[model samples]
Target: MPCCPFCSSDMVYPLLNTLRCKRCKNIWKEGEENPGRPAACGSEGTSLRIRKKTDPLETRMKRKLDEYLTRSKGKFCFSAMPWQAGDISQELFMRYLKRCVKDRSLAEEKDRYGRTWYLRP
Candidate 1:
């Protein structure tokens, strides 16, 4: 996930092998000038920028949850919950996560505590 250059928002999408910042609509390609990499600037307006990179399934889920919480303006009520989030609910989230893992062909992953989670394989 990439952070926005102007607002530090975690809305990013990959376009043509380049990372694009959704908030500011900034496009950066690897090996290019600036390269859209996260940088902590001390001058003004921008602080720390989060890199947009491929992440583990679990990590993605965490990021999604965090984003949801932030977007909902504290209206989200889940805490310490693990989910993938298609529409809503734990079951939907789990199902969505399983489908994602299968689609991404990451069928051989174990949870942090060695629990078999993905439905791929």
Candidate 2:
């Protein structure tokens, strides 16, 4: 079995040259040395390019806040409760949150800190 270059995990069987990480969903090509070389996904008609979708400003803010909060929850992290998630008054964050509510993208709930928490459905 080949190992992945990015994560060093076993290759996604059958496709020896392809390695996928579930945690990050990052795919890499295994090289001949230990990890196999990244196999080309190129094809005659395929553009062979992956593009990131530009998230709405609000969504972007929400994501940023999520990341910040995730990292902030340390031994002495901010004690803001779940109810405080709504305290994110950034215009972009509010817009995204409204959209999430309208589209049912995120769920509303209280956090350990009694703050409001949101997640994509």
Candidate 3:
């Protein structure tokens, strides 16, 4: 039930041969005086390492598309093509939208003037 030196959280647990802090996610060995700081490079024992989570490309595209549709009243003319997500190229953006339509996440409708509109299903 030792406290985390880095975050001062009491949510510390033994992981294999080391202690892990739930709050800061830092790992250190048991009975170590300074578990808050990482060991010097090339020294024995574990050093601090942090991993960041990132969404996949398709997931990111879907999120961006959802945001765009919401802003555009849940529908927009396909030909006008006003939405551009981040640094993605026009071709990639259209490809993602077309995939969504194919998967039935988005519906494609044609007006009397033969203009195509993409809308949420």
Candidate 4:
């Protein structure tokens, strides 16, 4: 799947002949050579600022999780997890955590208080 050039989100869908990014709601023509730059608008030929492509959400999440784990000595609960504000939700984070555990990249355990903690394997 092609990631959105604006938000680096994979949640994009085709709308007519163009593709629309669900995360940032930006629309661009499919197969465009430079998706990072918006098409020119009006007679003046003004266009939105071009954005540099960024890592996909999954990769970014992994990096943030790794940073937090390192800072916390390799163990952390969901409530204490660090992620960019408004970038993700608890449910999404849990889903990613599940994938990580399944991939054996991370380990999870329940403490006496029934709180789940995640750590690097």
Candidate 5:
């Protein structure tokens, strides 16, 4: 996830290759000036950015959960969660959701309508 340039919120969800910042409501596509390649810290061509370019499935799912919760404000229908993104499947999403619930980072609720909603802790 990327940090917002203004409010520094990590609410920026990775929508494909784009990052949408929730705090500043800024949509940032990786600028042409700085390509997505990882840069090493140095005196001349230095970058403070610690690029964890590779994230495990769990981290990505957690970010997705946060993004959904932030966007929904409270309760959200289960169908709202993106079922698939490129190679990532809905099964993987559910797996991580269950893991999140196990870790207490997220909770699940059932509405009067009997629909399930994933929530933040």
Candidate 6:
């Protein structure tokens, strides 16, 4: 557990080119002593990489949809409630959601009331 360089709080992460302390809100860079050191990152690729590709809208929606399914832990109906749509339209939403079902990236379950859930496959 690498602590924040400024506050010594155990929350530094991803070996940022300019790391920001979650607690102190200070920015820093890895020092010479930390080069090639192991970081507690879950990423399979090198954690010290300076640039990370941001997830595209579709990818982010898929990820968030998966997260929603896990949080609900059973059936999640998109129409039953209003969650963050995040620049996605109802038509496009249905398109991708159905695509996920067809491709088995997600599973579908219809409840008694006719509401549906998109579960992870």
Give each model's whole-structure lDDT.
Answer: 0.49, 0.44, 0.66, 0.68, 0.58, 0.60
Superposed by TM-score, candidate 3 places the C-alpha of residue 44 at a distance from the truth, in angstroms, of 27
Q: Across residues 1-121, which tens digit of lDDT does each residue of candidate 4 receive?
A: 4566666677977779776777665666654455355544231332333334377667767877887788889899866655555454556667788999999989999988898899887
Q: Write the per-residue lDDT of candidate 1 for residues 60-101, one digit (tens) a residue.
A: 555664575566553332343344444234653455456666
Error of 2 at 9 (Å): 48
Residue 9 alpha-carbon offset, candidate 1, angstroms: 1.3
lDDT of 5 at 35: 44
Ranking by lDDT: 4, 3, 6, 5, 1, 2
User: After aligning candidate 3 to the native by TM-score, how far in Å is the CA of 106 from where it should be?
Assistant: 1.2
Weakest ten-residue segment in model 2 by summed lDDT: 42-51
Q: Compute the lDDT for candidate 6.
A: 0.60
Cα-based lDDT at residue 104, candidate 4: 94
lDDT of 5 by residue, 12-91 (tens): 66676666655444455543345444432122342223223355545666677676677789555666654435323566
Lowest lDDT sum, 10 consecutive residues, model 3, at 44-53
Rank list by TM-score: 4, 3, 5, 6, 2, 1
Per-prediction TM-score to the true structure, in the order listed: 0.25, 0.29, 0.48, 0.55, 0.48, 0.47
**Each prediction's Cα RMSD?**
13.7, 14.4, 13.9, 7.4, 11.1, 12.7
Alpha-carbon runs more than 4 Å astray in model 2: 1-59, 62-66, 72-89, 111-114
| Candidate 6 per-residue C-alpha lDDT over 1-121 given as tens digits, one digit per residue, 9 for 90 to 100 | 3455334556665444566555544445543333454543442333332222365556766776766777787558877757774444555567778988999877999989898877776
Query: RMSD of model 6, in Å?
Result: 12.7
Supply the TM-score for candidate 2.
0.29
Model 5 residue 60 distance off true place after TM-score fit, in angstroms: 1.5
Model 6 alpha-carbon miss at residue 36, Å: 32
